[model samples]
Target: YQNDIGQREAERGHLARELHDNALHQLLMLKRSVEEPTAALEFPAAYELLVADLRQIISDLRPATLNYGLRPALDGLVDALSGRDENGPAISLDVSGAGESYGPEVDLHAYRIVQQACENALEHAHPRILTIRGRLEPDLIELTVEDDGQGFDVDAQLDLAKLVAHKHFGLAGLYERAAIIGAELQIDSAPGRGTGVRLTWHSRDK
Candidate 1:
């Protein structure tokens, strides 16, 4: 599943690049065409709007924030994911105790883990607050995504691997992801309380 996810992200990046290049080229051409005062295209404003929307889509598909580093990228992602609901899921992020960089691969996986966790919470939790915290210790790193929302019975959800065998790909995928990185994944939740997703990885992991 990790391989599949990586491949999909590669494909997505490729597609986004192609789309962005073509759209940008066309947008520039249109601007030049309109710049020729003789070319009487009254829809230049519409073209500009379309270009802005297309640029936004491209950014959404392939974020350049990753180039700045993991934590910055995650900060941008949180801003993008948080909704404008006055009373819904006011998201927050915290990063602490940085030692050596975790390397690009670990950062990639870490970002995906947090991204998916926030998405799942937004879709199902209907929460009042969602927080994603990262703690980089001397020998290990831990990520925690917590939400105050409608919680569930963890044991009921597990049912001794039965739930894992079937539906709930979001969570099962998270489990597989943590294992792939030699990380420990934990869930703390109870009905009417809230849910917390935690991923911990020691520096010894490959």
Candidate 2:
């Protein structure tokens, strides 16, 4: 358990470094060019390309703030996942309620949960309609990702033997992350039916 936590922390650190060295640095350089307009650079094209790359980097970071506060981050995720043009599956995002901030740990875990849920829907179930919902209540925040895709047996598949053998990928990781945040994760799905995932985080202030 300690090792796993350490590893996760390390990954977060690495991501932070990547953001600082790569994405932030590039943005700064681009900003300089934009400021100095007569620096022999093409007007819109260079600026546009630079901005696009910066956006891509920001998208890659996908900071946890989106998961804990405002709907913009998750909305960005939905838009990106939906791609430049909607391909096969249709994705929707809806967020409601107040409180747009959370502890760093809670935010990070929530962000990861959403990310994992989306990946599972895309790769495993290949759903036709995918929805990501976020609701912030007085004492808790709830996030749900639903997919009208083929479901699986949550219980049977979660057998100790199977889990030990490293079968399911995303759920277990999600469960651990939720546990870290003192949150609850619910997976509702069955064969031939759609999947609904619910994650609830309690407020620290009580």
Candidate 3:
């Protein structure tokens, strides 16, 4: 399953690159080449929207910031979510103790876990404020995604059979990813309290 997910991510990145280098480039050129006033105005406007949409799709498939590092990628994620709408929740990142290098797989899984948590909060919790915090050390890395949103019953939701039956895979996927990376996963939530997904990974576990 891990190999399959990695292969799919690779294919997504490849497709994103192809569309960016070929299709997006051609669209820009075509937009610039339009000379007529009306055609130029309309075409450029439409092309701009298309370009923005394509860029978002590409980013969704594979974040470009991941190439730099996990911190930048998580920063990008927070920025993107914060800018999603004028009324969107306030999102913040507070990370300390950097200069830690985990393998690409670990970094990617960590990002995905946070991403999934944030998405779940937005979709289900209607959070007012979403926070992502990280603590990186030589032997330990701790990451948490928390949201001030309407929480659910953690025990009921964590039933694997029930989750599969309900077609709700977000939480399940987080567990799977944590297990894949040998990380300890924890969820803290209640009926009225907010939800928090915390992941801790030890170097020794790797």
Candidate 4:
């Protein structure tokens, strides 16, 4: 399980590098093109547009507030998820906590968990409302992703001979991640109801 988590982390790092080096680099260059066109264009208007584009690009790169604190990081994450194209469901993100730094592994795992949940909602659930919430105390951080969509029968799935015969990896992946951070992953879903997943980690203080 440790090896699997390590491999996934490596893959995520590689993908992040590709996004930063290729996609973000192009966006920055495009932003510069409009802002640095010599005296050929309206300087003020072009500069303003470029500034907005640059802000978005930089936000995509690292998120300004995320570096400063948790609220910003989550704000940036919600913004990114909510900004998905027309196919994406409406999403609401709520965060609460005093400023405190978490281990990099915790932050990364939390971010990836939300990312996966959002993907599942978009590609599978077809939800109308998706809410991502995060709460932190002095000793723990809790994250939850809930969607008002058709849910599944967890028990039935678990009982299925085929599923038991071949290990399903979706929930397993999340379980492994929670273990890495000494956290717990709770999944609640019932047919005809909605689905909600919770990830909670013990704080260093604890």
TM-score of each: 0.68, 0.69, 0.76, 0.66
Q: Per-residue CA lDDT of candidate 3, range 1-206, in tens?
A: 64335435555676878777766876776666585555565676667766776776677666888777778888899988898888989999998876245778888888888998998999999989999997877677799999889999998788866665565667777887888889999999997789999999888644
The regions of model 2 sitting more than 4 angstroms off are 2-70
Candidate lDDT values, in order:
0.72, 0.74, 0.80, 0.69
Candidate 4 lDDT, 124-201, residue by residue in tens: 677888998878776778889899988888776644234323544445556666777888888889887888989888
Clashing pairs in 3: none
Report the C-alpha lDDT of model 1 over 58-118, residue by residue, as the tens digit: 6655466766666677788888876556566689988786434576666667677777788
Which window of 10 residues has the lowest lDDT sum in candidate 4?
160-169
Write the candidate numbers in order of decreasing lDDT: 3, 2, 1, 4
Cα lDDT tens digits for candidate 2, 1-206? 64355436655776788767765766666666677877436545555765766676565565634655645567667877898455769998887876466756676677778878988888889789999887967678789999999999988875534553463546666777788889999999998898998999888799
Q: Give the higher-TM-score candidate: 2 or 3.
A: 3
Please report, as a residue range, the 10-residue window in candidate 3 with the lowest summed lDDT. 2-11
lDDT of 3: 0.80
